[model samples]
Each structure stands twice: as C-alpha cells, then as structure tokens.
Target: MAQQQRATETKEALINAAAVVFGRQGYRATTLRDITREAAVTQGALYFHFDSKQELAEEIIRRQHTMSSGAGASFLASTESGLSSIVRLSGELAAQVLTQPVVRAGLRLSTESADDLAGAAAAPYRDWIGACRILLERAAAVGETREGLDLDAAAELVISSFTGAQFVSAALTGSEDLLERLERMWPVLLEGFVRDPDHPVLSSTSDLIYQSADRVA
Candidate 1:
C-alpha cells in the first residue's frame, strides 16, 4: 500500500511539473527531460511511470477531466436550480483556472495543440458539453431556463463562450483577469438564458457569488 501510495504521489508530482513546464514553454517545446528535471526525478523513473511524453500528457488531460467532472457534479448536487449551479460553477471554474497553474496550462494546451494532442483534449470537452446539456434540461424542467431553449445548443454555447473567454483572457490579461471577466460575464449570459420573470436582468455580483461558491465548494 505504501509503495502504491508513493508511486501515485510521484506520478502526480510529475504531472504537476509537466503542467508548469507545458504552460510556460508549451507542449512542442517541452521534453521528457524537462519534466523529469522539474519533477526532480530521473528519466528512468519517469519512464517507469509513463512510457512516453504523449502518455504523460494524456494522463494530465485525464486528471483534469476527472477534476472538472467532480467539480461539476458537486455543484449540480448542491444547487437546486441548474442555472444557478452553472453561474456558480462558472465562477468556481474560473477561480480554479486562475489559481491552478496545471489546470490553466492544460486548458491552454488543449486549445493551442488540439491537433497535436490528437483527441486527447477533445473528449473532456465533449463530456463537459454533455454534462451541461443535462444540467440545462434540468433547469428547464424547474423553470429556470427559458422556454423553447435548445438545451444541448445552449449548453454548448455556454461552454464554448467561457472556454473562448478563458483563452482570450489568458492570452491578453492573464488568469486573474480571466476570472474577473467571467464573473462579470456570467450574469449577463445567464440573464438571457434563464427564465426569470421577476428578475429579467441577471444581476452581476461576482464577488458575492464567488464567495458563496467558495464556501459551497
């Protein structure tokens, strides 16, 4: 058990190191030697855990997918309203992307090297879209989303918009600004999608929402 635990730790350490290196230098410029050096492990040790750099990269993507799914599930479970959950989840995701260097790098790499990464990064996104569709359908059932809103299409749009925004923010102002911008944008986007008769305009209180989400998360 101890040996297995240690191996797991080492693998995680290497993944984290790779995320930093990949985020900073990009996948094309990164090498196994760089990952090993960053992880403070020998090249042979890295190979013992992962056969190739591509494998390591895929593992990173897998880990990220697991993390994102867990986050989404937790948020959905906690909130009664789907739209509210999405608004809250968006903030949570933004905070994570800004704070976690590994996650941020993985997202950036996924977009920049979609072709190079082959379908590694694509599956996670598809999974997220499916999750969003389910959530939107639920929200519609609860009268949270607009009537006649195409659940799948709206979900895809929401994910794509946020993903694109994150990419732009990363490229332009960095992760901090990305989170700030997401907080601002969430209400505006939700307002149009949500079926609130009383509160037609989704009020932007990102700070308050973020604080609440942090507590819930």
Candidate 2:
C-alpha cells in the first residue's frame, strides 16, 4: 500500500513536470531526461511509470483534459442557465490559462504537435464539446438558451471561440489579458445567445472588466 501511494505520487509529479517542460519546449523538443529531471526522479523511475516520451505526453494530455472537464463541471454546477454557465466556465478557463503553467504547457504542446498528439488532444476536446452540447440542450429546454438555436452548433461555436481567444491572448498579451478580455466579452456574447429576455445584462465591457480586474488587483 505504501509503495502504491509513493508510485502514484511519483507518477503525478512526473506528469506535472512533463507538462511544464513540454509546454515550454514543445513535444519534439522535450526529452524524457528533461521530464525526469523536472520531476526529480530517476530515468528508471520515469520509465517504470511511462515506457516512453510519447506515452508520457499522452498521459499529460489525458490529465489536462480531465482537469479541464472537472473545472467545467464545477463552473456549470454554480449557474442555473446554460449560456451563463458557459460564460462563467469560460472565465474560469481563462483564469486557468493564466495561472496554471501545466495547463498552458499542455495547450501549447498539444497544438504544436497536433499531428503526433492528435489522438490524445482531439478526444478530450470532442468530449468537452459533447458535454457542452448536452448542457446547451438542457438549458434550451429550461428556457435558458434561445429557442431554435442549434445546440450542437452553438456549443461548438462557444468552445471554438473561447479556445481561439485563449490561444491568441496567451500568445500575445499573456493569460491576465486573456481573462480580462473574456470577462469583457462574456456578457456581450451572452446577450445574443441567451433566451432569457429578463436576464440582467451588464451594459458595458468596462463593468465586467473592471470587476474582474479589481479582483485580480
């Protein structure tokens, strides 16, 4: 039992360390030695947990998706409406991109090695989209989303837009700016998609941006 616990801890440490290094150096540029060194584990220990760098990378991708989905579930749990839930979730995701180096690295490494990481990266995103679609459909049934809105398409658009925005913001201005931008854009974007006519809309981007900025400040 003790051995199992130590092994689990070591594996998690390696995955996290690999995520950071892979994010910084990308998959092709990163080596197992780099991951082992980062994890403070011996090469034999790394190999004991993962047979190869490819395997390690895949595990990192899997863990990233799991962590992201968990966050999504948590954010969704907090909101009653689908559109609002998505907006809140987007804010949460953006905050993660800025604050979580492992996540940032996972996103970067996955994109950079799309050809190699296709299976590992794409499956999680598809699952996320599917989950969002289900959430949107439920929201529509409850009068949260606009009537006649194609749930699957709407969910895809929201996920794609936020992903693109996060990538651009992370690359150009950093995660903080990305979160700020998402907060500013969320209400405006939600106004068009939300079905609730009585849903309170913050009139200006400044309102949301400043509110978030104040929290971060």
Candidate with maximal lDDT: 1
Q: For residues 74-153, could you state the per-residue lDDT of candidate 2 as single tens digits? A: 64565455655565566555556666766777777666788887888788778778878867876787787777888778
Give per-residue CA lDDT, model 1, range 1-217, as digits (tens).
Answer: 9999988899888999998888777778999999999999989879889998878877777777776677788866765667767766777777677667667777877878887887898987898898888778778887877778888788898899889888889778765586677777776677668777554336644654576447534
List TM-scores for all candidates, in order.
0.87, 0.80
Q: Which residue runs does candidate 2 get wrong by more than 4 Å?
A: 1-6, 75-79, 195-198, 201-217
Which pairs of residues clash in candidate 1, taking residues 3 or more apart in a chain or in different chains? Answer: none
lDDT per model, in order? 0.77, 0.72
Clash totals for all candidate models: 0, 0
Consecutive 10-residue window with the lowest summed lDDT within model 1: 199-208
Off by over 4 Å in 1: 1-9, 197-201, 204-209
Show the colliding residue pairs in model 2: none
lDDT for position 14 in model 1: 92
